[model samples]
Target: MPRFSANLGFLWKDIALPDAIRAAKRAGFEAVECHWPYDFSTDSVNQALNDTGLPMVGINTRLGINGIDDLGVCAMPGREAEAKGYIDEAIAYAVAIGCRNINAVAGKTGSTDEAEAVYRRNLAYACAEAAKHDKTIVIEPLSHRAAPGYHLSNVEKGLETIKAVGVANLKLMFDVFHVQVMQGDLIERLRATLPHIGHIQIAAVPDRGEPDQGEVNYPDLLAALDDMGWDGYVGAEYHPRGTMEQGLGWLKAYQ
Candidate 1:
């Protein structure tokens, strides 16, 4: 059976960071990941992880004043320095917490040529930083409609960027929800692009809710992963339209 983990950044938005960790433990998750532990101190986050004995699967870099809901690092022009700083912080945090993956958002959209150049340069730098700590940096592609003009909003484009960078530590963060929205053929695409995939995130299509609430048949998806021998974690990166506990039922059933 596939191991289960939760993205507390989305699931427990209403509670404190430490409380979110507690809730994930209560929900029977063996591991957890988060966008940014903004609400809690590093010591507090460390304490929760230590107490729960739940490994942190991943953690996102800080977005600074833009915050996670607005936009983040990859969008700003001439912010390569700032972006590097953010990535460095995440690398340090991941090393401290024993995390293996770090998800890097490409911010908002930029001009095609400009975005491409910036993304490649920034990711190359970020990948080098992550490699120092033996962690992988996965670049996520949001749906085009959701992030218009953004470079890296589709798997094809993301793969191109990764190839351009040619950094071994850099790979794609394949989120099923975004891919289902922007590009169809999840399984085939996953197989074709398996070499570039470093991490995976799952959510129901349309609703971005529980896996069972939408059109995705996760059993088959998991089976595909098994066939491919995917070694990374399948991050539960979804929002619960209802209660958090209700959302966990699908994962429980999946296991």
Candidate 2:
């Protein structure tokens, strides 16, 4: 069976970061990831992970100028400095917590060559800095429906950017939810992008709720991951339909 990682960003949003990590452990998850755990000290987070022996899989960079309203600024023109600052901060935090992947948010921008150029340049820098610490930089493609104007809005764009960056440490965050919304060929896409993928996330499409409530068949999808020899953890990144525990029945299949 494939290992599963609890995404504290959604799974335990009401609790403290350290407690969330502990919660994930008690729930039988092998690992944990988060959207933003910056509010908590790395020491606290480290302590929880140490106590539970659950690996911190990955974390996302800070949002852009608009904060909650903006997803990121890495691909936004003229915000290169801001983007790098977020990248540096994320890397430092990830290192302190022994986290493996740093997600470089692409932010919102027009589908222009300049935006792509800026994104590529920033990714190159991020990859170089992260590689120094033996950390990987992963970028995800947000669906146009969920994040309108987001620069990296498709897997093809994300893959192309990784290739253009030409760095081994840079890879794609294959988020199943967004990919299903933007494109439907999940297995084929996974086959094509598997080698370049650093992490995988899953949630229900359309509603973004519990995995079992989605249009996609997660059991088959996860089985496909196993057949493909993927050794990485699949992040359970989704909001609970009710309480976190009440919606976790879907996890039993993998356990």
Candidate 3:
């Protein structure tokens, strides 16, 4: 079975982040990832991880003023300074907390050449800075339906950006939920992108809730990863239908 990581961003939204880390451990998760934990002190988060013996796997850069709609400023033209600042802050925090991966949010843009250029330049900077700390930077492609103008809205663009950056540590975050919504060919896509996949995440289709009721067969997907000899955490980044425990019936099989 594939190792699982609790995405504390969605799995335990009611409690403090440090407590959520402990909850993930109590719930039998091997590791944990978060959307944003900047509000909490690094010392506290690190203490929780050390206490639980669970590695904090990933965390996103600041979303800035536009929040989810802006996603991130890294790819937004005329916001290079702000984007780099977010990347710098994320890298510093990741190093402090022993997290290896940072999701550098590529803010929404009009798919213009200028925007693409800006994204590549900023990503190159992020990759270089992250390299100093032995960190990997990942870019996620949001579903066009859910995030219409996001810069990295499809796999092709994600791959292209990585290629343009031309760095070893820059990789793609293969979020199955969004990939399924944007492109139906998961297996082939995974195969093609496996070399550059830095992390994987899962959620139900359409609803973005528990994976058990989704159109995608998560067991088969996990099996596919196993078959490919891909040993990495499949992040459970889904919103619970009820309490987190109530929606975790599907996790028993995986665990």
Question: How far off is model 3, as Cα RMSD?
Answer: 0.9
Q: What tens digits encode model 1's per-residue C-alpha lDDT throughout 1-255?
A: 567678987888798877888888888887888988755677888899899998888888776566644367654667887888888888888887788888777776554677668877878888888888889988888886666645567899888888888989888888999998998799999999999998888988888887886778788988898899897778888879898876677867765
Sorting all predicted structures by lDDT, with the top scorer first, yields 3, 2, 1
For candidate 2, lDDT tens digit of each residue in 24-71? 998999999999999999999999999999999999999977985668
Query: What residue pairs clash in candidate 2, if any at all?
Result: 72-107
lDDT of 3 by residue, 8-67 (tens): 998888999999999999988999999999999999999999999999999999987779
Each prediction's TM-score against the native? 0.92, 0.97, 0.98
How high a TM-score does candidate 1 get? Answer: 0.92
TM-score of 3: 0.98
> lDDT of all the models against the reference?
0.80, 0.90, 0.91
- Clashing residue pairs in candidate 1, if any? 109-149, 109-150
Off by over 4 Å in 1: 68-70
Single out the weakest 10-residue window by summed lDDT for candidate 2.
246-255
Model 2: residue 254 alpha-carbon error in angstroms: 2.1
lDDT of 3: 0.91
Report the Cα lDDT for candidate 2. 0.90
